[model samples]
Target: MSLLSGLPLQFSIDVSSLLNVVWLGSIFVFFIYGQRLQMYLIANDISRALNRLKIMRDKSRKEAIDYFTSSGKVTGDPTQRIDEFLDYVTIMPVDMDPRGVVEKVQHITNTRDERVRAEVSQIIPNLDPTKVSVAENILEIATSLNQIHKIVRHYYLLGKKTNSYMLLFQLQMIMPMVLQEADALVNAVDTFKLGQPVGDGIGPVIASRYMQNLPKQVVGKDTVMTVGEYKGRTLYVLKAEGPMGYVGEPGVAIQKLIEEMKVPLNAIIMVDAALKLEGEKTGEIAEGVGAAIGGIGVDKFKIEEVSSTHKIPVYAILVKQSILEAITVMRKEIAEASDKVQVLINRVIEEKTKEGDKVLLAGIGNTLGVGQ
Candidate 1:
């Protein structure tokens, strides 16, 4: 009382207590405000990046459509032109933290705002069974894997303990199986073998006894026969019939076809099965001139030299899959050859055949007996 004699009784509280309260309140306010600022910055950056990506994608799409419909006739080789468009589109800087984006979108979805949810769903790629049943199945498996990952992360966060050893051992065993399953799924998605049912109507025409009996020779198990009618056009379609690693061997058949068929060097198109990325929808096609066919020594080197020397336009159509699972993912640059190529995705070969399309269909992969 003597120390606070000059002040009112209410103002004679402990100086230390008063200072402590003031300091704590200031810190609390600062922390709350700082957190809000950080969230704002992150949201703004994500929004900007997404908007930029959309602009680039739309621009590329328009360019492609314009080129296709500009002239009454499809000119300048559709395959080459499509490839060029894809190269321009993929060059856009759209990659961000996929997980963070997913989380942000999911939060919006939970708000039950129909418009917002619908917009977010487009970016997320709906896991509807009708669109892609396999993708839906994989999503279910991913959910289980996510749970397992969480348990492992929790154990890791805790300091070394008795159960830690058991957890580590279990994680080690589970990882390989998870990886194997992922690989299998990616392979299944990448290697799209459209069933023979779709090929029924067209197959009879292409496989009629008259066409089958044409001048043909079994060039090392692969029947090389002349079919289509193109005067002075000796079209040789090289269908790889070997193991996965033997894509280069087909080049030999190709060289022989060039020499025997005497086909114009510029009219050649090398078709092969290619692995696509997760974002690439199945049946999406593009055309590019790239050396995707793998092999060592003479097989690969020779093809490159020959194609280059002839100044012939080479085109490729790659199927999409996960890069983590398949090392042979299709190259984006392959789509930027000349302005004459077109790479069509998610294309049904059977459907293409019905349209009277004379395509050099190259099933690029380890062709170890049909269903790989």
Candidate 2:
């Protein structure tokens, strides 16, 4: 045995060593305790935000039911409520107040933390200006900033306890989806260009203008038809007014147009608005090549069978809008679909409007409870 190993006659620790151990242990305890507290706080904030969102959604649903039963026309107020609910769902954070999160992030950025600041900044650019009310924007921005700050702070703490490389890899994988959604929201606001036409009795004006210049190749006067070519592809357009709850005629019109055009059925694309979850925004767009004819049983069955038989890529571009606001909202989806399919959503009254500049808009849905 060494001499030092046998030198325990003092039976006491050195004061300096005792102080050092106490200091280090205190720090470790504080760090662990602090992290737990922060996590709890974040969880509480998320719960509160979710509760608020649920309340808003419930209120919106009740309002929609009331309006539908009483007014007989789907009004803008109820639709706006739905839009608000969608916005809330899309933007809410998983663990914190988005505004507070963002503010905290901004602080870290100002303090010269480039790595974390970059991540926060990416989400910042994608926020939709139209979604939030002016007052709400102020509060939300602050909340998001703070939440982001907490995220970064938590991440820093985690790095001290574990390897940051794994955390960074996880973030890299998940951030893209979040960024894509944000981009979609921003693009929806920036490039959305429907509902711009204004005039008293504009619908009739549009209908009459279209009727006078109906294309010869298109069959039937009661059924107005327009033709256009987009991206070196030919397109046939048809529009008609039928009785309420009439979704059959549009399918018939499509068959007639297909026969007249002599184009292969497999190449055709169909676009229309669909009733979606209240969490989906009114003008949100989804693309899939399938028959868009709406209604239960026979009507939908026939259209689906026809498309399936022909091997046609029938694409449906559905706008997530209320069924009661079908006419206006469905029109918007048709226009968006046309744009997406690289076809024009406009009508040509004269041949002066190039074929590439026009697109076919089919207003398809149960016309039940529709019209002025």
Candidate 3:
């Protein structure tokens, strides 16, 4: 303060200017600090969301194991603890491709299914295959719901905290689809757990119920293709061999009947449930062209390929319902549609082809809680 202050002839300082500068510098630092604080908050929220996701995944995994524990007949012993194995299990995305995708998607689903069945077999040797399938479907849906909820919630919270209008806008835009899928997953799990017939299984039930009463023989892929005399045509009815829950590789079954059985199929008719748009009445019947199968398009691909190659005209008879109804408990309207569809099938067969001509009828859908 003595020597240095005196020597400051080279530099000059204004006290009032210095004070103002210090104030401005402080303000600048605080502005930067505030910006960093905002960034930290956004990042922390996202991190917390991801951590929540992990917790949900682990929780669902535990729940699945607990479900197996409660089913003594399935798990061999209900009291015994089983190690949780499905944590972070990878499920493949559905293939939306029109061609050359079934093998890839099927490999993933088939491998997982085999692994699940094997695990069940290992844990409770000689366990019923049907129970294992049910557990697998339920576990899959539970996992899906957990994933959807956590992801959508993460974005939702992030948008809210940051007040980012665009981010929130986009999230709002897509949340309906996310919610729809979650609802369907929840419905499917409930339907399976309740042992109730789902809307998707109605068409398959009719085909299965009718086929069971007829004198039938195995054609291909364990699909029972029966020849029945309808009007003048020898109607060949095909459905995935069931008493178990399966959508029965209808694509391959049709391929076998067409490419292998090589029966002179004059017309091809398929039946299944279809998703109706909002405002459309449930259980409404719609008849059109093409295979009425809902999946990753592998089965649809096979049907289209074979039908096109064989020059067989394809006719579709569909029962319309909401996505929830398709997976949830079958509604009374849908249950009644079974009889209506049966009559429609008979009329389609009678009108579509000539007498003495051979026709192929494939019932396509998950045959859960359905007989024959």
Candidate 4:
């Protein structure tokens, strides 16, 4: 009774009002806290996802060290290109489709190619023919890094359209992971001094090996293709020649070989690197019928155009690998896959061609680490 008497008069007579006040206050507090809790949870999830991506990027970086060392090509630190390359990224319009966008990319690539060649020539007067490949790789690595930054930044800006703070924050957190990937890619490419194979080089590797000990003829301004006998078939093999900077004008070379060289091709076989599925093994080779090439489709179009006119059956042999495997230092598995692919090519020729038939076999892709 003494303690109760010390309380305010309102506590004595306003019991229902006080209880109502407390109940409303509790609801308001919970509403604010619930929103805050949800924000934190979402933020936490985004952080976790970004962290996983970073881990994958880090693993890729570690693998790159070995790739560079084994290739025996990279000399100086090529990593400096990656940082300066960011300024070169093209800001693509959000409304544009990717199909048309690569045209601009090709233009950018060509410019870089010219710039790199000139720089290399200037640095080492009467440059060693072998060093040309290294220069090309440096320029290509710069372009690739720039493209990555362009892609990530483009999307990050697009996300800003929503005007959501949380969304922007999520994208911001993921940027470093992408940059890390760019760094890894640049280092690996600098190490290899060849365009990352990206499954595209398989065809060239096979073609070069097949053409071994055969006479190589200059088929185009920059193309070195071979005409030789393989398994009782007269094989006209075309690929971008290398060991000096070259991925040859394959599209132009193929068109000329059929329409101009008039080889009387019985069958047209294209071997190239193919993108593997998520669960697919790296360096797995598959045989089938189709173009089996990945690029701006210029080469594929020319091949199809000439083959269609001549009524030749086009066959495909695809070497499977992930984008990473294809573009980074040439992996041993991929190198092994090349030998296996040659066996398959021989089998394909035997099954598809008759004795003395003139056949045109094209190893289509960048022939950086390959030769005629």
Top-scoring candidate (TM-score): 3
Q: Could you give candidate 4's per-residue lDDT for residues 1-372 as a string of tens digits?
A: 977776777575688788888999989887878656655555555455445544444443333434333445555543443334324444443435665544565555556656666644544445455555655455555556545545554554454455455665666677656655565564555445543443456677788776888888988746787778977888888887665546666767877887787678899888888878879888888888866666666556667777788888989988787666666666788778887877778888898889999887888766665666
Q: What is the C-alpha lDDT profile of model 3 across 80-192, one tens digit per residue?
A: 32334433365665557635466777778667767766666666555565666666666676557666766777776777687675675566566556556655665566577
- 243, model 3: CA deviation in Å? 2.9
- The parts of candidate 4 lying over 4 Å away from their true place are 1-112, 154-162, 165-184, 193-200
lDDT of 2 by residue, 160-230 (tens): 35744455444434544433332332222211122211111112222223344445232432244566544
Per-residue lDDT over 95-167 for candidate 1, one digit per residue giving the tens place of the 0 to 100 score: 3755345335433433322332232233234333122222222222233333334444454334134434444
The C-alpha local distance difference test score for the whole of candidate 2 amounts to 0.39
Backbone clashes for every candidate come to: 33, 29, 1, 6
User: What are the TM-scores, per candidate, against the unseen true structure?
Assistant: 0.34, 0.33, 0.75, 0.69
lDDT of 3 at 234: 86
How far out, in Å, is residue 65 in model 4?
A: 18
Kindly provide the TM-score of model 4 when superposed on the true structure, using C-alpha atoms.
0.69
Q: What ranges in model 1 sit over 4 Å off?
A: 1-215, 220-227, 230-232, 241-248, 259-264, 295-299, 322-363, 366-372
Clashing pairs in 4: 196-327, 197-326, 198-326, 198-327, 199-273, 200-273
Candidate lDDT scores, in order, read: 0.37, 0.39, 0.72, 0.66
TM-score of 1: 0.34
Which residues of candidate 2, in runs, are more than 4 Å off?
A: 1-222, 242-248, 259-262, 327-363, 366-372
